[model samples]
Target: MTDETLHLRRLRSPIGRIEVVGDGRAVTSLAIERDGMLPHDGEDESGDPVLDRAVAQLEEYFAGTRHDFDVPVDLHGTAFQRAVWEQIVQLQWGEVVSYGDLGQATGRATAGRAVGGAVGANPVPIIVPCHRVLGADGRITGYSGGEGIPTKSWLLEHEGVPHTVPASARPRATDVTAAELDLPADAPAA
Candidate 1:
């Protein structure tokens, strides 16, 4: 594998400034800038084509004009983490998958907590859509990116799911029908 230097560029967004990092072939990471502000007069795009594509897609997303990302991600993770990330990628737009559901989807029925760990460690947060993962009871749970659970709720809301509520007051999880998730009738939620 060629070792490419990570190139980073800044993109201004309604929520804040997002720093995008990538090699020439694929985007490696996109994270919210800590200050939530962009410089007033500098160039807003990273010159790399891959990063530019990601910026455009993300802009479309925040504007409600696009629902899914098209840019490829050079996701770095352990084998198990990669499996977990794949399931995250397969999640349909506007659909929220519980951590337990994600674990079962990856054939690790008893590894929900482990899957949650992997999800939190995801390198590319928004593009990979780890924010769509929820608790088993439909309650919003741990989110390590940006503003944490609030950020998770924001992303979910952006995707047309208004399931955000304080953890203490979250409603009971909606019935996770087997048909909706494509699991066998004998599967956990089935």
Candidate 2:
């Protein structure tokens, strides 16, 4: 059971600090920094039931142990944004889709820029898998969520996809988790 207040919490990942917001029943928003100020300080990981579940899932994801997220989501977006987000969720782990392609998937084949706008505003990045979306030529463009495009590439690499990082940058394993890695439980056999 939860009090009536909206929930928020800070979770430290190998990448950086993550701020999560929820309404007790479902996660509403997740950001890298302490996402905007709320009325009440949300309980820590172990104290809030909703937060505890979210943190656990995120930790498992960073460890490359879980692929899909099963938690309920409470996204507040316009109808078009909701449609785009729904398409994003359909993307399987390790799969990447171009912005134009996403527009097509949402039956808005000519709304590529509009699609990009929605992708940028995606309140939840990882679990909804917004990083899985890309620009033309399958190259990464702007990704302001979490730790930025590096985290996106890292996520792709973790998913066993050959993703290109910025410049000569390569994501070190330590950027993901501190614990010894578990042999990627479900990385697709190449």
RMSD of each: 11.4, 4.9
User: TM-score per candidate, in order?
Assistant: 0.77, 0.79
lDDT per model vs. reference: 0.71, 0.73
Per-residue accuracy of model 1 over 43-140 as CA lDDT, tens digit each: 33445788878877876676566778889899988999999999898877888888888888889989977998999999888889898888867778
Candidate 2 backbone clash number: 0
Q: What pairs collide in candidate 2?
A: none
- What is the per-residue lDDT of model 2 for residues 134-167, given as tens digits with 9 covering 90 to 100? 8777677868675467667767767777656667
Give the Cα error of residue 27 in candidate 2, in Å: 0.1
Could you tell me how far off, in angstroms, the CA of residue 172 lies in candidate 1 after the best superposition?
23
Superposing every Cα of model 2 onto the true structure, what RMSD results?
Answer: 4.9
